[model samples]
Target chain A: MSSPERSSTPMALIVVAWALVVIPLLYGLVQTIRTASALFTG
Target chain B: MAVPGFLARDRIVAKPGFNRWLIPPAALAVHLCIGQVYATSVYKAALVADFESSLTAIGAIFSIAIVMLGLSAALFGTWVDRNGPRAAMFTSACFWSVGFLVGAAGIATNQLWLLYLGYGVLGGIGLGIGYISPVSTLIKWFPDRPGLATGMAIMGFGGGALIATPLSRQLMSLYDSSYDGTAATTPSGSAVALLFVTFGLVYLVFMMFGAAIVRVPAEGWKPDGFDPSTVKSKALVTTDSVSAANAIKTPQFWLLWIVLFCNVTAGIGILEQASPMVQDFFRDGDASLVTAAAAAGFVGLLSLFNMAGRFVWSSTSDVIGRKGIYMVYLGVGLLLYVALATVGSSAVWLFVLLAALIISFYGGGFATIPAYLRDLFGTYQVGAIHGRLLTAWSAAGVAGPLIVNGVLDTQGTPGELVAGDYRIALFIMVGLLAVGFVANLLVKPVASKWHEPKSQTSPTPERSAAR
Candidate 1:
């Protein structure tokens, strides 16, 4: 529900939650890319 | 009576300025953590050797957890809605983490039954509750874009595997000094036990987000600019609510069950066979067009698409409408299966492209259904309805593999099979998609007798604020 009040999410909490989701995905992506690159080089 | 301070039922009460956007991340926190269920195979062989038990026995542990997941959701769906997400999440976090702890002890002591009881039965109840705990709240919060909201969380379930697979390997290597990270070299028994304990503690801390931050909207709090009238214009979308008990009696409910069943079963026809299918398609006596390593890469590529499709297609459903999006999944799915059947294996790029798209639709099929349930059944007991419907996934889990494996076994062994050997299974998948299409077409709004009385449908200020 929309409220006239601005987002109450703490600036600190936002970083942590985003990190919770984004960091793992980024790591997985880098690992996958490395594996794919090796496959091509071989 | 709920325990003082422990009873989180009051968390559902929406305060005046509560932010709805925080809810998706909270839901993601739980789903991603519990989704480690898919990565259990990373430890399977090690457990088998350590306990000196069969692979079947170890695999049964996962089966117990999944079956319990469905049963717990069906039994507790209504209780969850009444008690609220915080309570359900709290209990789920307890069961899930305890299941891991018990499982860790089981592995340490080399007791198989303890492992099953801890991770299988108790942990499954955790999975079921955790899975559904966020659904009804997400729907209520994002009534205007239920598809997009639920999709973000459910997509976590799909992505959880991607994260878990690698993380499990890394954790195992970290714990086991002797570890060489390869499929053949397994993690140590002690290492797996430690892994379980670590997962238990990590998940307990993570799942608390939904339990703490989640709140229900106060009565009559619609998002700004959202017209309640627009929901009616979408086919089968309803403003009314249905009791979870009466919902099963309706044809629409069963039809949706069928839609989910057929879609999941058809999708698994590819997923279950992904590794072998690519290799088999290009086999030529001793020289295969696709290498075994290349085929593994293909599987990894499909996993990425599978996760993406859950977020992308389900979010798209918000714009095109729920029923219209399902039509895309089923109708286009049928055509894709046909292409894979008739002319698949013709080229490297062609086969990969079609297979990846098909898998995306597979993931899309799962992510979109919760929003569809919200559309047809109303948010009254959607979590429970969703809980009951997961029985379709469990059923398809068995049936899909049987059809594919059965058909393939008849053709030839895995490596020796050729493109022609799979045409039968591919055609079968096309037929399965067709059945899903018809089920989608048959869905309609629930009748009035089953609907929650009008007064109860809207959140009342007195009752919401009563706590």
Candidate 2:
């Protein structure tokens, strides 16, 4: 698993990692903005 | 290295060229899964009907898990540092998901104690281990910015709840066609069993992503262009090591414990009643200014602040020292509570802004504490210290709710109460924040007598020698 040939992280692993983190944060951000707007307008 | 216990160790170990940024997502995977514990309320009513139990009886499940989380973290934090993140995370995966599996069985068989034992005790041990598994490794890797590293990971715990709550509600609806996504309706017992099993299976894969990728830095590794001396120069920051055992003996430790306790007590006390509090604040005539949906929106807004503050304020502590950051959390927190007591009901915007800011500081307090521990103690047992410090959180979890509810009960029920009803509790929150403020002032650098000798700076597998 720690071979010299496998020096770089796989592309798939990088994509999954970014997706896992970025996706939820974006969703939460979008939802929060919506609620925040309502807080003032209400 | 060939042993079963260390199977994924080599796979996750970072090679020379590996980027440190890759680590946070791995940590996020584990945290997001366990954060589902906060989503339990979505199923509480469902379980109440399924098991024919009172809401208080069901609420005890989450309570036991949180208590166990504190205990297990304090107990097993050192084991995590010694054995490495992979081993600790894998063990966490087994305990956490298995706890859910056992809980599924309990639900199926209608055994309440089994639910308590399964989800409460076993899952809690998993939460504690899972919570701290990445902390030591992340700190060691990013010694340049310990606050940012630990905050990124701890932030996930708060974020996890956000993801789980909606997902669980949707899943419950899917499982029981009759569930209309409301509080009154309970999903089918079989559906709950299925939900438990699904969560267990999903979380295993998610947590393993972290376990499979997490690696400790080699002895004395530092990031490019990072100055080791600069970190040391920051106020009250140190490279001096304190054993987790000795750390507790230090006045700094108790000071931090009280600091964390008060901050948490105030925040959790308010947060536990967020939905109800919003209605209580603005309720006037028969038709209150704040409706249920608006109240829910306010709760959602607070959750966002709660989660984001974990990353934003804690990371800010890297630039502004941990002590300064906590001063803001406590000092400003006291002011906000006062405003909420005196002027909160004057305008909806004022109430919302103050509550959100207070929650952000609360989240910041949690994420910043480990780095705070690192500054006063050192990395050698920072995870363990962080674990022990979490007992403050468990204590606050109980005390916070008690303070809020006791006051609220005497004032009036949730909907009938107005801002006046909350004046007493809000003042108490101010008093609690002042205590934390005083504790922060008392914290100074640890004494030289406690420092680990220079030769033993590198991590050792031996627990007795390591701390």
Candidate 3:
């Protein structure tokens, strides 16, 4: 089977792609700060 | 006359669908996890407090891990290329997970050597393999967009600490009963062990996802609308593909190595002592405004800038070209270091901001160099060349911390709060960046002798027929 061809420059796709990347990163960041705080305090 | 068949087979290129994207993310997942090396200071502080160890003794663990990262990467890089990223990544996952588990056990038992062996030696192996695995594959997939693609994967590496630093701190807190600053009252050894095991399992799964999705494009294939000429015209020294093996022999490779070594060493000096440095700077005769929590937070903020630089500045390289990008990293980086040395105590915010920018450039340097190599050397063996160049990182890892801590120690005032103490170290970093700037300027195009012209040989009938 051939590779699926999506629009190369779709705004929606780019937005979704960025969202996927950003959300996990932000979540990770929150987790990091929370952990550091606990370590320092504990 | 003797062996046309042997020569033809050696010249044959592998078909596409070798799994490129899968490799970089796989590499990233492991690297991001191993990037915990940056956060080892937190553990060191805890160890120092709990075991009542000397700073030099505590530092030995981190030093061992870093030294091992360089040695193992150089040794395993060739293996990854020969065996493929799957085996290499899987091995990395195993060693890294075990290292954490071993470290957890060491903490429970209060056995410092085990922590050193586990995290330093075992985990260091994971770092070496994970780092080099996806580099060449990413370059292959985005031969036309090497900087951006390689940057995407490597940027994750810079960000890895951003995630690990805080997460580890949290995990330590969760497992411990008391929230005391003193390390002696922290959690049981078994609790730390459990956390390591959990982290390992999660990392293994994420890395496997990356490995499963990676595929190499067909040989000579370009993205449907991509133009090779556009890439060549935009880059500093354009060349057709050269395998990673041959790429190292060229002057461009050595110049790139010097650039990375300088950038990494400069950034690491600050990173190694980020928390203490912030505390010392803001400390006054009456009382210090910078709390331990704030210092850790500052480290996290630096991590944010470090991570951001990796993605943003390196991606910018795709547009402005790698050489132009390095000029920014080196030139702007030097200015920021100078500003920090001079204006650091007078205006605290400026020091923080400038320091963040310098750290970002440090992260950006690591993320961007892969693309720089892709620009000068073909993707054929970029991984190997990148692997070889990592010896510079190994060297800087030792040099950076030694310069920072050595200066701090020799001053003979561990508890004597002072801002001017770090001035000499900052100047040292400035000189290093200057050397890097000169090395970057000296980089010339790869000689034509190194290029592999297509006309020198014909394609195999079987491969051509398949296409």
Find the candidate with the highest lDDT and give its number: 2
Clashing residue pairs found in predicted model 2: B46-B186
> After aligning candidate 3 to the native by TM-score, how far in Å is the CA of B343 from where it should be?
1.6
Give stretches of model 1 more than 4 Å off. A1-11, A33-42, B1-6, B458-467
Clashes of each: 0, 1, 20
Per-residue lDDT for B75-140 in model 3, tens only?
Answer: 766566544555666677778878878876776678889888988899888888888877776776
Candidate 2 chain B: worst-modelled 10 consecutive residues by lDDT: B1-10
Fnat for each predicted structure, in order: 0.19, 0.40, 0.11
> Model 2: per-residue lDDT, tens digit, B24-117?
8878888888888877887887789899999899999999999999999999877776677888888899899999999999999999999999
**Measured against the native two-chain assembly using Cα atoms, what DockQ does each of the candidate structures obtain, in the order listed?**
0.31, 0.40, 0.17
Q: Docking quality tier of candidate 1?
A: acceptable
Q: Name the docking class for model 3.
A: incorrect
| Candidate 1 chain B superposition, TM-score | 0.94
Where model 3 places Cα greater than 4 Å from the true spot, the runs are A1-24, A31-42, B1-27, B46-55, B105-111, B179-185, B452-467
DockQ, 0 to 1 scale, candidate 1:
0.31
Model 2 per-residue lDDT at B345: 90
The candidate with the higher lDDT, 1 or 2, is 2
